[model samples]
Target: MCAQGTYITCANSPGQNFTGCACGQCAPPGCDGCVVHLAGGSTLRG
Candidate 1:
């Protein structure tokens, strides 16, 4: 399970079983989505 202020991501593959964590809080209110910073200074919205 993800921590309270962390986000999770996976590569574009089926059954690859890879998990990654991004440092940020899940979107507030419902906390149903996440926003994270990418390596190239971009933001990923999900």
Candidate 2:
């Protein structure tokens, strides 16, 4: 998480799960296909 608006925020995401967009599997519409793949599970395509 070092891109412009896409920065890492532990405060925002307390769970810190790799399932969220912060890690991988981006949301639909405005944001998609941006993954980090910290561990398990691959990325999801929009």
> When superposed on Cα atoms, how far off is each prediction in RMSD?
11.8, 11.1
Q: How would you encode candidate 1's per-residue C-alpha lDDT over 1-46 as one tens digit per residue? A: 5433343333332233223344243333333344453545555665
Clashing residue pairs found in predicted model 2 = none
List the lowest-lDDT window of 10 residues for candidate 1.
10-19
lDDT by residue (tens digit), candidate 2, 1-46? 3333332223334444333435333432333234343334443232
lDDT of each: 0.40, 0.35
* Candidate 1 displacement at residue 27 in angstroms: 9.8
State TM-scores per candidate. Answer: 0.28, 0.19
Q: After superposition, how far is residue 12 of candidate 2 from its true place, in Å?
A: 0.4
Maximum-lDDT candidate: 1
